[model samples]
Target: MLIDRYNSQLLMVDVQERLAPAIADIAGVEAQIAILLRTAREMAVPVIISEQYRKGLGGTLPSLAGLMPGVQPIEKMEFSCFANADLQAALSGNPGNATILCGIEAHVCVLQTALEMRAAGRLVFVVADAVGSRRPESRSVALDRMRMAGIDVVTTEMVLFEWLRSAAAPEFKPVSQLIR
Candidate 1:
């Protein structure tokens, strides 16, 4: 299914300062997420960000945090964002039924969240290139598991173009420039 921009929200999971450094190719992952965040803002798509164990993991990376000024990251101990009441409430508040996930430890938080969200009957799309784990093998296996469970494994460009839908969109120029 195509990702309907008006019917979807962006969820950034645990791209914290302390935790992010441990993910392989974290720089590339963050860059992709940045593109998503910027596009989300440009398209008026609601965004929800989560930070796992903020005290230990520290807050979202300064570079990423700055992308969405004034947006507070949800603090959660649960690996699945759906398990956290606050995060759940935040998600429930958004009208969108589809969620786009991007973040660290694809095998852990990202994987669990995608499965749980999918099971809950919401359309879940995990941006593969925007998610990472310390071990590439772990990320690979997690992607396979998510796919087997019927989750859509997508790339940043796929999302960008889907969200834009066409070159006639007013956001076309600015959003398209994000990747370049």
Candidate 2:
């Protein structure tokens, strides 16, 4: 089934400054994340970003931070954002019942969160193009695990087009500009 915008929420997990620098495909991951963030903003999709541990990892890199709204992130100590109290509640609070996840350390944080969301019966989609880890193998494994667990694997433009729905939709022009 196509993921509808009304039922979708964007989750940016642990895209921290200290960690992103160590990831192998930092450039590719960041580019997709920027597109994800900008699309979220233009499409009016609700977004929540988590910082794993502010003191060490620092906040999500400065560039992504600037694109997001002023919502203070749900600071999490747990690898999975689902394990954190504030993040869990805020994610549950969003009207979009389906969640789209993207972040760093794909094998760990992204994997666990996708599993948890599946247990909670939410329609979860992981944008494979938008997630990464320090090693290519871990990212590959995480995607395999999530797919095995029944999570849908999607991409940045896949989401942009899905969320946009129809060319005549009002958000089409603005969001298309982001992809362009």
Top lDDT prediction, candidate number: 1
Determine the C-alpha RMSD for candidate 1 after optimal superposition of all C-alphas.
Answer: 1.0
Query: What TM-score does model 1 achieve against the real structure?
Result: 0.97
lDDT of 1: 0.93
Backbone clashes, candidate 1: 0
lDDT of 1 by residue, 1-180 (tens): 999999889999999988888889999999999999999989988899999998999999999889999689999999999989999888777545689999988999999999988888878999999999999999999999999999999999999999989999999999989988
* Per-residue C-alpha lDDT of model 2 across residues 1-180, encoded as one tens digit per residue: 797887778899988888999998889999899999888887778898989989988988888888895756789989888888899998899644789999988999999999998988888999999999999999999999999999999999999999888999998888888777
Question: Which lDDT values do the candidates have, in the order given?
Answer: 0.93, 0.88
Task: Compute each candidate's TM-score over C-alphas.
Answer: 0.97, 0.96
Stretches of candidate 2 off by over 4 Å are: 94-96
